[model samples]
Target: MNEELLKMLNAINSKKEEAKKLVMEDKIEEAKTAKDELIKLQNKFDIAKDLFDQQEKSKDEEIKNKVKKLTVEDEEKKGHNAFVNVFTAGVLKKAVNEEDVKIYNQMTEADPTEGVSDGGLTVPQDIRTQVKELRRSLDALEPFINVEPVTTLSGSRVIEVNADQVPFDNVDEAAQFPDVDTPKFKNISYKVVKKGGILKVTRELLQDSAENILSYLTNWIGKKARVTRNFLILNELDSSFGGDKTKTLNNFDSFKDIFNVVLDPSIAISSSVLTNQDGFNWLDKQKDSDGKYILQPNPVNATQKLLFGRYPVAVVSNKVLKSAVEGAPEAPTGYKYPFYMGDLKEAITIFDRESLSIEFSNEAGDLWGKDLTGAKVRERLDIKTIDTEAVVKGEVSVTV
Candidate 1:
């Protein structure tokens, strides 16, 4: 636009210079003609300038409107309205005025699926965020299990697994085989169990302090489920398949024996380790020839705690992997720290039938009379040992 305007100005200056030259030559008629041409050029330039100015003004107005729309003040106003709609209008059923109540009632009527009277509001996104943030209080045990979602609550799933191949001598191609060997498989049955807790809260707290109450209860229930399931898995491994591929370590030097057992060619070596903090601290002190710690960060994935840079290690709480007296049958005196190392997912499989679900009700049997609301959260999951040989469990004496 500026270039076009410059061209017009240059044309006008050229016409004026021509007019002056004509006047100096005493050609009055030609000079007057040049002046008229200059006037016409000036008029065109003025029209173009006016159009450019109008275009610039419109562009400035558009930019100002966009900036106003995107301002933090506008966003804050929207947030305030959202908060009011969720908390006051929806949950508490309150209205700032008659106009807001009408709007809120209309919104409620439009979406019949919201609120406890309906199927229960999808547990507000903000409340869910609070739940997740609080869930970090529990120990991180998600990596130990390969979770799968299933629609059926109870059913049997067929799993085809490769067994250790039998050894055979070389035979001629034309010779008939003695016997055929095929891979073995077993049926894995899954059943969902209802695991949850009911929390009673006063009406005042529900209306005024929903966030804090939800966070606390969700954390409590989550911890219970996680800790309970983790221990069940560890206990089942010890009770049901303890004697399979066992390795009892008497000294720190023999720690490699457990690793070798897991990494043995006969079984899958892609594994993780689970032990109490005491066991982890013991392994943490083990040094190489260069006097460096053996428990180094995993090279493949930096987030994992690798043992000898080979296997990921998860520190189960002492409550689950408890210290017990384990020696020879004749003399069971020394304190033994239990450790599990192997293909964790293959060894102990967790079958989840449903995700964690929560519901709130103000009208329960006793809660209604007591004027309290009940928040209940539950999940469906069960654990079973899939392949005993895939994992190896051992105990190390703390005295050693």
Candidate 2:
């Protein structure tokens, strides 16, 4: 548009020059015609300039609207941050601004289902998501087992096929059907239980920034929650296995038999080996007759180790999965470590209530006298073994 206007203005200027030349040359009629053409060109230029100005104005308005939308989004983010700061101050039982008290109350009183009146405050959604991600880093057993989210405090899941059964018999056409054996079912019941602990914070730590305070709290809660769940699942796995089913890995051949002979072919296809750090260390040192290491790098995941070039091996901390020494005095001592191999997802199920609640107290125990604050975090969940045959509990012992 601007270019068009520039061209029109240049044409008008030329016509004016032509008109002036004609008048100087005494061409009166030609000069009048040139003057009329110059006036018409000026009018067209004026119209085009107005339209260009309107277009520029429209573009400016569009830019302003976008800026205003971005400002609103930034303000919303600032508001949420302010709320989190106020809530964090309240949790630490520190002094909060009077104007921001409403924000704190909104967080506490917004959800009656969370039992806020009883002093329990639900962790903010964003913080919860962060904590969950952190918890996964510390988890060992939870990721492998089947997790079922449940709303009820207590419930039961019925298993129609507990074990492999015989297939139906063939029948002739138009012949009477033969009677079949009644199917058996096993009911696995679970009741959610509370697992929680108190984390004490020094007065100095409470005075830190809200982000730092939340980070400390989340790290503590995530680790504790993961450890509690891992302990419960491991306990259930131990209880499900019978003495007859549990075996000792005396040599490399014995370890291979766990997948080839002990576990069912169907279960072995999807099985993984689980052991503590101590057991893994022993297995990592094993060698074949050709002097090659038995533990190979997993083809699918290079970070993980595979046994028999097939099953993935999962290693947990020795502190979590402890080792036991068995044998009489003066005899060769056996450092027995757990070597559980099987399809863990099909073996156990965790009924998760999916609720984590936190409460704060300044007067709990010696916190008040010490000028410290205590935050109590609680988690609810239940674990049960669905199939005992899905896993083989083997003890890998290092004898000396």
Candidate 3:
């Protein structure tokens, strides 16, 4: 509502400035002409006396005058900064990784042992200081050092589905392998059409130099890189979290933006494991008579270290669905929903066979972006992937 008014006010302000400049430079004739234009504009604006008067009042006066803020938003806006442009029209596209958790704590029939201490990796402060000093001393030769910045991800259980009891030599190769009945793989495959996952990155656990170093690191890379990607993080094989100097070793306990998740595999799995162990440090060891390791596992609750950039979401909006049902006499006689808005980016769109629809890459480059507002926008990535199977037959159905 204030858009039109703002345009007028900005023009008035520009003209006033121009008039002041012209008069100061001794351009009397030009200044007079500009002043005349300003006067005319002011006169035109004066017709809306109620709006102009309302805008002239200070915020405090306006607030005291009105008890209900929302009901009198026009008055409230007048009291607030008029130059603000809230970018509410921006679109959100997020990706996430879905993981199937295997029960690692399941009893595999092992013997109970009276153990006071399990050899855990605990680097002493003095040793850490010594190593840090050594690094500082060798700063000149640091670049030449062939340090291994390797990551070993763990606990990614085989991707499985309950639909059919299909045997697999390897779940990773299932897509390439033939179905039991199809003898030879007849190019029959299921592309990841919809995926819903989330990584909630948080900054809830940091202290001292740890905090200082973390702060420095975040300032260097966090907002700058602003890069996102798909990866299987293989850094869980060692106690030292992967040697990515750009990232953290212990955890993501320094960021406050929760709900934004890091869709990395290693970080997700390792974080999940550590989360399960947090409550166990409080438990005292015990003995069991049945000769079984009756480890009283603590109540495990993970805060889902929010780095999962976004709660990956996928939604079959009207636009998307219309595109999905294109070309057929029936509008999507059937639709398979494997994801919600939270399921986006689980499986990247290897191919978008749907025409006039857009798909975005990590760099924010969009394909088929110009026609995004049309009815061809699909809600399902699967429907967007196959050209032969899915077709758009009808023209866009939009109502004004």
Candidate 4:
């Protein structure tokens, strides 16, 4: 099936090139014929790919059944033991004991393609799911932004409306319709980039119970993934609107102006405030004329803080959203804390290409000699800002 899909894809590419050549040669009819064939081939490829995915899912179910049988046979052991056994065997290049051998044999019998040579053993589905959940839970910014799951490596999305443009006009009945501003559509393209790191494990840690090992690995990977994604997202927001859209707010009244005067009401309605701990500290110190703190607890979610009792404030740690250090001696506190207010879901989009993939190795470098193994984990995704006008960036400075 994979071979057939590749062949079809190649044919489509060839047909596309042929059509381009025909168009260049002024043969419109020939180009049209080639394009029709190309479309047909694309449809066939889609069908085949869907079928292939179904078959792969079916195989995964079968593998799960085999794992279930193994668990039943060893009622005292945890379900994660099977994964531990596989990991041990892959790293050691051999089974450690009779039970390890039995478990490894069952896994290979269930899925022959999971050998160490085949791009390392794909982490078990259950563990992968847990890791994914942990990552999402730990990431502070992901829940509020637009997240899109995509299967392809690269693609483009059409933005239907220009955020800054007013494309509508009012007209009287029976009057000649005046030409309103035409809606300008924009295309945002994304390509997934691989982000990964290696986790070095000591021999003693690997010797722990299966559940403990799994817990430790998942926690580490989850936090690392969260930090990596947060860094990328914050950087994207800064680069997109940090230039002309940035504002400087000193007092409580100026901060209020972000929503009241800086941003359009349409955008302000759906906007939230994002700031570092330093900026939040500044806001926390502000009081109204009645001596009430401007930042109050959110009415709906008491645990969350709200700015002006309207917009929720998301406070990122100063470590994650670092302040810029000033060069001059007279600069207040020598740092500028970043503050962002906007509809983040409209401002940024995250294209998730695939889930977390982990591979273990004992032979990497001098691991065998030092009795240390490395677990390499990788994630693929892309981040893009679709609407710059939806967000306002601010930098706040205060004297010590």
Candidate 5:
């Protein structure tokens, strides 16, 4: 636009200079003709230029109006889902990165599902990086999860999710509980994930249930404990068994079946053997009952205790259970599996008849280590390394 305007201005200025020269030479008739021609050309140019300027100004005004319309200030009163897409994207990156690292690092002996590891990090890193790039396009958006405002369009006001095709039920209370930016996604819905600031999973958190689970997991499991998980949907089951893998007393399924049977009945469990020591006196350490050992007799009061007297119960599907119980036990009613007596201490599961099951085998696929037990999750946004004393003793640092 400026270039074209300059061209026109220069044309008029040059013609004016020529006309002045024609007058200075005292060539009156020639000067009049030259002046008249210049005036006519200038008038012709103005006619076309007026329309062009009008169009240009109109375009400028239109763009300015659009800029005003999209202002964050304008959207503030509207519950505009300014950040939904970008937020969801960020959420997605965090979830996938965590999942990939977690599932990949799981006990390889148990999974036997090996893939090539990339510098100790999996190839999923590539996918997360790509998603983050797409997320960058949303930088202009204000980070938001908008709630629909009540409007006179109907009556009073209405609260609705503004995102199209995304689950816009309500503000994910989980999105900001236990302090903002705290880990809350897994507790909110173990299956549901955040992506592009959108709900990208099949589940939603039941506020009360999620809160309780989060609390329990936080209390039992240390906040710093690294939990690894792999979500598997049991679409079909091979519920048949007869040979070496069958549920006879000495077989693998038999042991798993027994443990499953005992654990399924309750959410919690207790082992009197661990919690109650008749001859040994753990209580004796607190005989004076001061400082760290401040309580005597029952250190665990009616409400609080750091120790889990027994192994915690876990949830598994009925199909897995039925498959485990495919073969019947041949033992007498009073008889028990040798594992129940804690016989295999070094490399086998120790299954006690009363209340505890010790998972000891390196190859044993125990569900206990497979999940976060519904703890809230937050990504560190940076790589971390295992720096235990063993590494120090070896004069090495195991980094990831």
Candidate 6:
């Protein structure tokens, strides 16, 4: 839009210059004609300029309008600033090892626990934020999942399907008409799942070292959650939802052939491809008759790779989409590399009930005998396949 406006403005300036040149050359009649055309162009330019100005806004101003305002209380509750005192202000007196005590202070300063009375610590907000950011960056399946932060732990999403009533080929000019199709709705529920692990840290390490233990712990837990969530998403995508076997692509074919089977023509152009490393490797090696690579760089995001110059590609781990093995006749050959393609935004939904939560216990049975403190991190989330038909799955094996 901005580029178009700039071109229009340049044209207007050029016309004005031509009109001025005509007047300077003493061509009175020609100048009048030029000025007349200039006036008309100016009118159109004025309308376009007004529209352009209205549409263009400072990026900072736009960001400010979209982002929620932070209050003083919220600011105060943010990072190390909030937890520094809670963990360092004579909180852990029982841990006698000075080295362990130093490590604990460093951890607390990084991510302070809310209540230190029961030897349990509430992870700081900044640590949680950092962990989530890291997880999003590292998680391969994150790009393809539709994430929604919901207040409730469990809720239902309604998927609407319109009846496939054929359009009338011919009808009387004044004849009565009926409804084209009835809409059908399918209700799918999302139920949160809880996952957490307890880890023991020695008192010496907690008190002695200057390492950012909180960041390390939060990152570990965040990655663990991402792995678990990706596995669940893969399972949901592979499930026999609605028994729509037509959406499956079990054999190798041309891009158009496979894409047509997996996605509707109307929504096929801007889609996504999710598969294992083997699947992407095969796609990356594909070429046209001229030997040009079939896959292209995504225009929307320069950092991303696109399939056939259209769909973005995400390569999941073999655990989610099994890798292929060649030269073994006895081994499984069919669907070894599961490939899923479609508008995942319309198919898969992830509901986050709560952000990540971290809790610590000094007296946990698992760590009590070992003189270590236990930390557990958990999050509440769920995945749902909103539209089974919108997503297509297939298997392809290609050697590169």
Q: Best TM-score goes to which candidate?
A: 2
Instruction: List candidate 2 segments past 4 Å from native.
Output: 1-118, 166-180, 242-244, 327-332
Residue 292 displacement (Å), model 2:
1.7
Error of 6 at 243 (Å): 11
Model 6, 92-113: lDDT tens per residue?
4343234433444454453333
In candidate 3, position 360 carries an lDDT of 22
Candidates' C-alpha lDDT: 0.66, 0.79, 0.28, 0.79, 0.29, 0.64
lDDT of 2 at 400: 78
lDDT of candidate 2 over 1-400, digit per residue (tens): 6778889999999999999999999999999999999999999999889999999999999999999999987754544455445546656555555444454445434443333334456665556666677777853578888999999999999897734584577899999999877778888999999989988868676567756767787788888878888888878888887366678778888877888898889999999998899889998998999999999998789999999999999999888888776787557477788888999999999898877777778887898898776778887888988987899888876777
Off by over 4 Å in 4: 1-79, 95-111, 163-182, 328-332, 363-366
Residue range 1-400, candidate 1, lDDT tens digits:
6999999999999999999999999999999999999999999999999999999999999999999877955644443344343433323334334443344334334343334343233333333444544543546454575656677788777776664464465778899867756657889898877776766656565455434544455566656666666666767778755755557877655667666644555443577778887788777787878898888987777766787666788886776577676576567656777787777777677676645545656677898798776766666777777776677778777653
Residue 27 lDDT in candidate 2: 100
Superposition error at 265 for model 6 (Å):
2.8
**Which stretch of 10 consecutive residues in model 2 shows the poorest summed lDDT?**
108-117
Model 5 lDDT-worst window of ten: 387-396
Q: Is candidate 1 or candidate 4 better by TM-score?
A: 4
The Cα error of candidate 6 at residue 345, in Å, is 1.7
Per-residue lDDT tens digits of candidate 4, residues 268-345?
999999888888888888888999998899878988989878899988788878777776655545677788888999
Work out the TM-score per prediction: 0.60, 0.73, 0.14, 0.70, 0.22, 0.63
Candidate 6 local Cα displacement, residue 335, angstroms = 8.3
For model 1, the superposed segments whose C-alpha errors exceed 4 Å read 1-138, 163-180, 209-218, 243-246, 262-268, 288-292, 297-305, 325-334, 359-372
Q: What TM value does model 5 have?
A: 0.22
**Models, CA RMSD each:** 9.3, 8.3, 32.4, 21.8, 29.4, 13.1
lDDT of 6: 0.64
